[model samples]
Target: MITGASSGIGAAAARLFAAQGAAVVLMARREERLRALAAELTASGARALAVPGDVASEADAAHAVKVAVTEFGGLDCAFNNAGYATAGTPLHETDAAVYERTMDVNVRGVWNCMRHQIPAMVSRGGGSIVNTSSVAGTRATGASAAYVAAKHAVIGLTRAAAAEYGERGVRVNALVVGSTRTEMMEQVLRTAPELEDRFAADAIQKRMAAPVEVARAAAWLCGDGSSFVTGAAVPVDGGATAT
Candidate 1:
């Protein structure tokens, strides 16, 4: 299952996971785009289903997982990638609603998904779960303070879940994502055009990642290839956090 699967890294992961022969359940607020992607994948002979809903809603999260188990038989993997960010605004100037929304989608979304997904995964004997964090998860990164805090919570949640469930055969990990050329990043760049150069330069590769780059890491983590990796904040950041 993948949240935020309508676009950006989530969409890329949905396509990649489906092509790799995984049954995918996509959850997102955009019903039209989600169903369109699911139809495209289904036409290509992949097992894909669209479950449109906000990840931040506990009931919606439960419903998505239930649909995944019903349609696909069981849940073996999940990419909890839905997130929200508001940059360029100083903390003092940032509205409380912005902070709440940021935390709701980024932190609480992952929490809600995991709360429901873990049981199905445990019943299956084992599973892999990948949560999306950010370079801001560890550093300020000039993003809004709310975004930074929320991402930090994501990493914490990933580690705690990994510890609690590893013995039960469920592995949890997070991606320390860098500046990527995703729709979200485009919005950030639009609001703070001057930060583009800085964003690129922050990475050792001197460029933002493509959505597929991050998606590949997620696929690797979710598959058996990374069987021994759990609770890791694996970097898909082109060395942005390496220094």
Candidate 2:
């Protein structure tokens, strides 16, 4: 199952997973987009189910998981990729609502999904979970303080959950993603055109990562190819964290 599967990294991951013969459950709040993608996958003779709902809501998260389990039989892997980014701003100048919204979706939403997904996976013996985190989780300048704080919490959650569930046969990991070319990043560039150069300059590769690049990393963590890897924050960041 993949959340935020309507676009960007989530959508790319869904397509790749489907192509590789995994029956995918796509979740996103955008019904039209989700349905369109699901149709495309179906046309290619791949199994796909689109569940439209906000990850921020506990009920929605639960429902999405239920749909996956019921429709696809059981979930072997989940990418809790739903998240949001508030406009970059200084801590003092940011609105409280913006901070709350960001945390609700980026942090608490993942927590909610895991609360349900872990049990579902446990019932089936074992599973892998990959949460979407960002370079902001480790660096200071990638996003606003609230976003950074929430991403840091995501990394913490990934580690704690990994340790707690590793013995129970669940593998939990995080992706320390770098700047990627997505609608969100494009919007940021439109609003603050200078950020493009700044982002490019920060990464050793001096360019934004393609969404498929991150999607490939996510697939690795979900598959038996990474059987022994867990509690890892694998960087798909083009050496941004190395510097």
Candidate 3:
């Protein structure tokens, strides 16, 4: 199952996982995109389903998982990648509603997804979960205080969930992503094109990552390849944290 599967890393992960023979369930706010991707995957011989809804809604989260179980037989993995943020203006200058909105989608959204995903995984012997975080999850960046705080909370939640579910055959992990070329980064770049080079410089590799690059890490954590891995903040950043 993949939330935010309509685009970016979430969409990339769904494609990669389906190509690897895993039945994928796509979830996001855009029903058209989700159904379109599902059709494309099905055409390629993958079992796919589209469930469109907001991750912030617990009912939506739960329903997505249920569809995966009913259609694909059982839930094996999930990527909680739905998130939002407009800019990184200083906290004092930020609107209160913006802060709450960021928290609702980034933090509570992950919480909502895991609450249902874990049980579904447990019922089927075990599974893996990959939640999206950021370099801001570990260090201060140019983003707003709310985005940083909410991302940090994702790591906290991942660790706690990993500890509680490891013995139960479930592995929970997070991605400490950095300067990726996605809609999120595009939102920042559209206003300051010159900042693209600056963002690239922040990464030791001197370039933004393709969403597929991060999707590969997420796929590894979800598959048996990383069975021993849990509670990890795997960095998909182009060595952004190295600095």
lDDT (C-alpha) at residue 4 in model 3: 88
lDDT (C-alpha, whole model) for all candidates: 0.96, 0.93, 0.92
lDDT per residue (tens digit) for residues 145-206 in model 3: 99999999999999999999999999999999998888878987886676787778989999
How many residue pairs clash in model 3? Answer: 1
Could you give candidate 1's per-residue lDDT for residues 1-243 as a string of tens digits?
999999999999999999999999999999999999999999999999999999989999999999999887999999999999877699999999999999999999999999999999999999999999999999999999999999999999999999999999999999999999989989998899999999999999999999999999999999889999999999989999989
Q: How many backbone clashes does candidate 1 have?
A: 0
Ordering by lDDT: 1, 2, 3
Best of the candidates, TM-score: 1
Give the alpha carbon lDDT tens digit for every residue of 1-243 in model 2.
999999999999999999999999999999999999999999999999999998899999999899889988888999999888865888999999999999999998999999999999999999999999999998786588999999999999999999999998999999999999988788778878878888888889999999999999999999999999999999999999998
Candidate 2 worst ten-residue window by lDDT: 81-90
- How well does each candidate superpose onto the true structure, as a TM-score? 0.99, 0.98, 0.97
How far does residue 50 in candidate 2 sit from its true spot (Å)?
A: 0.5
Q: How many collisions per candidate?
A: 0, 0, 1
Q: What is the Å distance of residue 18 in model 2 from its true position?
A: 0.4
